[model samples]
Target chain A: MNIAVVGLGIIGGSFCKAIKKYTDHRVIGINRTKSTAEKALKEGAIDEIGTHESLENADLIILSMYPQAVVDYVSRYGEYIKKGAVVTDVSGIKRAICPQMTELSEKFGFVFAGSHPMAGKETNGFDVSDADLYKNASYIIVPCNAGDSVVNMLSDFAKSIGFGTVKITTPEEHDRMIAFTSQLPHVLACSYVLSPCCPNHKGFSAGSYRDVSRVANINSTLWSELFLENKDPLISELDILIENITKIKDAIKAEDTDALKALLEKGREVKQALGE
Target chain B: MNIAVVGLGIIGGSFCKAIKKYTDHRVIGINRTKSTAEKALKEGAIDEIGTHESLENADLIILSMYPQAVVDYVSRYGEYIKKGAVVTDVSGIKRAICPQMTELSEKFGFVFAGSHPMAGKETNGFDVSDADLYKNASYIIVPCNAGDSVVNMLSDFAKSIGFGTVKITTPEEHDRMIAFTSQLPHVLACSYVLSPCCPNHKGFSAGSYRDVSRVANINSTLWSELFLENKDPLISELDILIENITKIKDAIKAEDTDALKALLEKGREVKQALGE
Candidate 1:
């Protein structure tokens, strides 16, 4: 199988490397910056640096870019993509991107499936990409009008490349869950670090501070785009988080030990039930 | 030197193991549950299971217990402790504990200084205690009227047991800083995990989810006491956090991309400046 991976950032570069490392699939790397593709080629992660013409030969096309970029790329190069080829994306948000790609795929005679690999590092770009980035990570697939055979192939491919679980769900469900699990945590981390006391946390902090503030070192531009694109769901999650925090604040302010203990116990119970 | 570690829970047990592994000090382990001290002695983490009488021979007495338990033990056994012995504690909150311990030290002739080791795991108990738990971790000391000699000795002892940095400050400053750096994160994590969406977060979660919810599997009884003890400072920090989260929530609700981007950029800048 010939796999064309567009956008040689960390996610794209990692997919290329994982495919090359784990299977006999020929990987063609494409990127806005030719240097990244060239670097991946030199590292033997990809068979070649790809042109738009390479789309015609690809059995699978993975768009590993931002939501807007993924939409634009498919629109611009849809005609060149081979009929029956399965096109998937590794974007964080999917509700807006999947429908647009599905419509474009219909016009171009290709299959569109929206995918999100639930794994990443703090750093970005091809230099930090790893073949094991997807190891033991969850993979979500939104079958946006794609046939069952294509979805099954993508699920098998995800497993082969070290994904421990592959969940098939609608784009709406994916966005809703991502809002709570991914985007809200990023927002919480960002907000948590903006406190006046953050600068003086050197000797005062431990695991909790590290865990809460870890995602604050974010790709601001990319995240801002993601936040705005999934505005309603993200806002809803943020409101609930803020409200929940307020309850704790009120309990602490009133010096209500029982109320505070109850809240903390509830949280522990919820987490305990998850058995993570 | 004789080292008496009272309260053989995770922190106390770890202290015993670390001292045994890294130094030649005779360790006497004491606990409300005598079985725990016996286990520590049998495991070679301590030279003996300590009695209250063992306090007479100690050069350093470590109260590795809850804040109130530390005060109660010191008050109950103040007469037994060797004169001029430096006594310290590993409590989360310092403002409340330090003054009481300081007054008791004056009455008992033992020098008192409060200390908090900035290290922990989600799980507790002597069974999970690790010898290297303090390796490269921060240690904060509240010099509650202790002399320079005692402070220096405590600092040297901390370093010998694998602490990378020893920060000396007032009880007020320690409580204020810890409210933001330590306590607030726990509150945030607890509140974050209480969301209805947490149970279904299996395939939808990744590093951010794992990090944010890591501390939610807490010892609720222990944390409730710590939170109420440092009520004022923790409440102030929680208010600030809620306000900061509100700003992000407002921007997303208004669909103001530029404002959202700027807020995210500020968080990134703050985290990057920390250089962690």
Candidate 2:
């Protein structure tokens, strides 16, 4: 099987590595830069460097670009992809891109199964890509115009590459949850580092500080696009989180132990419920 | 040297282990419950289980109890401690307890140097106690009424027990930094778990969710006491953190991409500055 991975950055480069390592698929590297493609080629992540004109030969194409870039790619290359071929993405948010990709898939007779693999690092680029990046991580399959057989093959591909679970959800549900689990955390981490106490936190921080601030070191250029693309849901998540933070603040200001204890207990209960 | 740990919980038990493992001190474990003391002894965390009467034999006694409980224990038994004996605490916050401890140290003729070890687990008790828990962790020696020699000895002792760095600061400075670094992170972790989206986060959650929520599983009884004990400093910290959260919320609400990007960039800067 021929597989083309678009945008040879971290996610895309990782997909090429995983596909080459785990399956018999002839992985092809596609990137906006020759340097990145050359790096992926040297890393042995792809069989050959492929161009836009050769995209129709790909039996499965994975769009590992940002949300906006995914939309643009599907729009530009919708008519060029092979008929009845399967295409997926490693995009963070789905609501904005999946609908357009679904329409394009239908019009072009290709399968655009929107996927989101819940794994990556603070570092990016092809040089940092790892074949084992997706091991024990989630890979959600957002059902677009892509049919069951296409999704099954994609799921098999995901599992073959060491994804722990392959879940199915709508684009709306995916975006809503992503806003809470992914997008909100990035916002919280970013805001947390801006605290007045951060400069003096040199010798004082431990597990909690490290855990909460790990994602604060993020890719601004990509995340800014992600934050606005899923604006409504992300804003809603921000509201809920702000309310939660305020609740703790009010409890502390009042010095109400019972109220504070109750809130903390509720939080503990929520943490228990996560069972992660 | 004879070392007494007055509370055979997680922190206290770990202290006993560290003292026993690193130095030739005869470590004695004391607790409100005899079972905990016996368990600490059986686990080799303590040389022997000691009573309040035997605390006078301890040349270096550590008050590894919760904030309110530590206050109660010291007030009741401060008179029984040995003259010129060095005493310290492994409490999370220092402001509420340090002044009172200083007064007690003066009256009782014992040295009280406040110490905050920035290392702990979500779990509690002697069963989970580790001797090397403090390795490469922050250990702050807060100067109260304790003399320079006693503070120096305490710092050396902390370093001997595998601490990464031994810092010296005023009680007020320690509390201010801790309010942001320690207490606020706990509050954030606890409160972050209470999001409405949490119950539904089964397979969708990954590193960031896990990172932010790691400390959510907390010792509610102890944390509630700590929060109330350091109410003033903690409330101010909470105010600042909530304001930061609100800033991001406003940026997202306004769809101000530049502002959002700047916020994210600042967070990245903070993360990089950590040098961890």
Candidate 3:
């Protein structure tokens, strides 16, 4: 199989490396910056540097760019993509991208499935990409209009490249869950670190501080775009988080030990139930 | 030196194991549960089970129980502790324990210094305690009228137990910093998992979710006591966090991308400055 990976950033470069390391698939790397594609080629992460003409030969096309960039890339290169080819994306949010990609796939006679690999590092770019980035991570497949065969193909491919699980859901469900699990945590981390006390946390901190503030070192430009694109869901999650925090704060302020204990116990129960 | 560790929970048990692994001190284990002390002795983590009579021969006494328990124990056994012995605690909160321990030291003639080991796992109990639990973790010392020599002795002891750094500060400063670094993160994590969406986060979550919610699996009873004991400082930190989250929420709700970007950028800057 010939796999064309567009945008040689962290996600794309990692996908290229994983495919090269795990399977016989020929990977063609494409990037806005030719240097990143050249670097991946030099490292043997990809078989060749891809041009728009290469889309006609690709069995699978993975778009690994920002949310809007994924949509825009498909629109600009739709005509060049071969019929029956599978096209997927590694976007964090899907509501805005899935529907449009489905429409474009129908028009172009290709298969469009929105995928999000639930894994990442704090750093970005091809420099830090790893073949094991997707190892034991969940791979979410939002079958926009793609059939069962397309979904299964993507799932099998993900598993071959070390994904532990493949979850099938709709784009709406994906956005809603991502809002709580991903975007909201980022917001909390960012806000948690903005406190006046953050600068002085050197000697006094431990695991709790490290965990809460770990995601605060973020890609601000990319995240701001994602936050605005999924505005309603992200905002809703943020409001709930803020309200929940206020309840705990109020309990502490009133010195209501019972109330505070109950709240903490509830959280512990929820976490224990997850059995992670 | 003769060392008496008056508790056999996670912290106390770990201290015993660390001392046995890294030093030649004779460790005496004490616990409300006699079985736990026997187990520590059987495991060779401690040399003997401690009694009130044993306290008189000890050169160092470590109170590794809850904040109030530490106070109550010192008050109950102050007369038995040997003169010139260095006494310390491993409680999370300091403001409430430090001054009380200092006065008890004056009355009993044993040197008292409040200490907090800045490392822990989500699980507890002696069974899970490890000798290297303090490896590369911070050890905070609140010098509650203990002179430089006593402070130095405690600092050296912590380093011998694998602590990477020893931080010395006043009880008030320790409490203020801990409110933000440790207590507030627990509050945030607890409140975060309380969301209606947590149970459904199995496949939808990744590192951000795991990091932010990790501490939610807390010892509720222990944390509630710590939170209430350091109520003012924790509440102040919580309020600031709430306000900061609100500002970000307002920007996202208003679709003010520039404002959202700037807020995220500030968080990134702070995290980068920490260089962790």
Candidate 4:
């Protein structure tokens, strides 16, 4: 397969390297910055570097930019994609992106399968990309159509890149899960780092403090856009977490030690059972 | 100095083993169960094994029992402590035990200082104890009287056990810091594990998921008791965390991407600045 990878940064660069390692796919790197595309080719992330004009002949197109850029890219260049070419993405949120991607694919006569590889680093760019970036990670596949031949292709692509589990879900399900598992945890970690108590004992921390706040040290600009774009589901997840936390507060206020113990015990049990 | 360690659990066993490894302090291990103390001795954790009755003439006594049992041990055997013996505890919380310990020390004619080593494993007991567990970890000293001779002794002891930093703070400061930095993080991690998305995607988790939730699989009974004992400080820390989190939520709702980004950026900065 001839693969055209747009936005040759961390995700795109890593995808190209991984595809070459696992399959016979020949990757053509495309980036807004000519220097980045040249770097990707020099790093062997892609078999060749190409302009946006190469979109017309590719068998598969992978969008690896941020969410808003994705919208712009599809709107402008998506119409030039080859008919029946499978289009996919590596965006974190699926619900908002899937519909628009599906719309563009229909208009351009291609197949759209939305994906989210649960692999990322605090650092960004092609310089940090690696072929094994997605090893043992989760890959959520949100096919626009269940019966599309491209669904299997997308699944195989995900497996080839070292994803341990490939889950098939709706766009809404993907969004909700991402909000709960990723967005809320990052928000909580950042907030915990900003708390006054954290500042008070900065000198006394160990691995626990570092581990809890590692993700909080992410690129703020990218995360802010992600939080804004996925606001609805993020808000929903935050509400639920806050509500559960309030129960802890109320139990404390009532001086119900037993109730408090029960709450913490339940939390511990639930967390432990996840490992099962 | 002769060192007597009461309660041959992970903390006490590790203390004995570390003392034996790094110092000439003759460690006498005491446990409610004879087998545990024998195991500690056979494993070379201590110079000798003893019953509670043998705590009589030790120059330094380290109380390494559960928080609840510490007070009981003090009340039951406070008089058995030799005159001018410096007593210290390895308890997590300090405020709850400080006043009573002071009074008990005054009546018994011994100096009581509190110490908390910021190192532990997920598993408990002497079976998992190691001499080097405290290497490079923080050791917090909570002394009621700043200039007391026992404070110097405890500081030297903490250093002798391979602790990199010996931080001096009041009992109240210690309790509040533990609540914010340690207790609150544990609570959040356990709650994140309990979320529906976590359980649903248990099979699809990456290293990030395991890294964030590793502490969630803690011992519930002990943690619940700890939380219940430090309810006030934990709740206060939780409120502060909640306020910051709610700010993130409002930013998401308003689509104030810049504000959200700034918060995350600050969090990253603060987290990175710690322990530097």
- Please name the candidate that would achieve the greatest DockQ relative to the true structure: 3
Per-model TM-score on C-alpha atoms? 0.99, 0.96, 0.99, 0.90
DockQ each: 0.85, 0.75, 0.88, 0.55
Model 1 DockQ (Cα-based): 0.85
Interface RMSD of each: 0.9, 1.4, 0.9, 2.2
CAPRI category for model 2: medium
Please identify which of the two predictions, 2 or 4, would achieve the higher DockQ against the true structure.
2
lDDT on C-alpha atoms for all candidate structures: 0.91, 0.84, 0.92, 0.81
Off by over 4 Å in 2: none
Local accuracy of candidate 1 as per-residue lDDT tens digits, B1-276:
999999888899899999999999999988889788788989999998878889998999999988998898888888999999999999999989987888998999999999999999888999989999999999998889798888899999999999999999988889898998888888888888877788899999999999988888888788888988998888888888888889998998888889988999999999999896
Tell me the tens digit of each residue's lDDT in model 3 across B19-100.
9999999999988899999999999999999887799989999999999999999899899999989999999999899888
Clashing pairs in 2: none
Interface RMSD of 3: 0.9
Native-to-model Cα distance after best TM-score fit, residue A177 in candidate 2, in Å: 0.8
lDDT of 3 at A240: 88
What does chain B score (TM) in every candidate?
0.98, 0.95, 0.98, 0.93
lDDT of 1 by residue, A73-171 (tens): 889989999999999999889888987898999999999999999999888999999999999999999998988898999999999999999999998
> What is candidate 4's lDDT per residue for A1-276, written digit by digit as tens?
899999877888889989988888899999989898888888778888887789987998999988878878989987788988888888888777877887887787888888788888766888888899988787888887535567777888789878888888888877777787677778987898887877666546676666677687677877787778788888988988888777877877787778767777777777667553
State the lDDT of candidate 2 residue by residue for B1-276, as single tens digits.
899999877788888899889988899888889998887888788899899987899999988888767778888998889999998898888888888888888888998888888888888887787899999998988878888898888888888998999888887888788787788888888777787888888678788888888888887888888888778888887777778877877877788999988888888888888764
> In candidate 2 chain A, where is summed lDDT lowest over 10 consecutive residues?
A267-276
True contacts kept of 3: 0.93
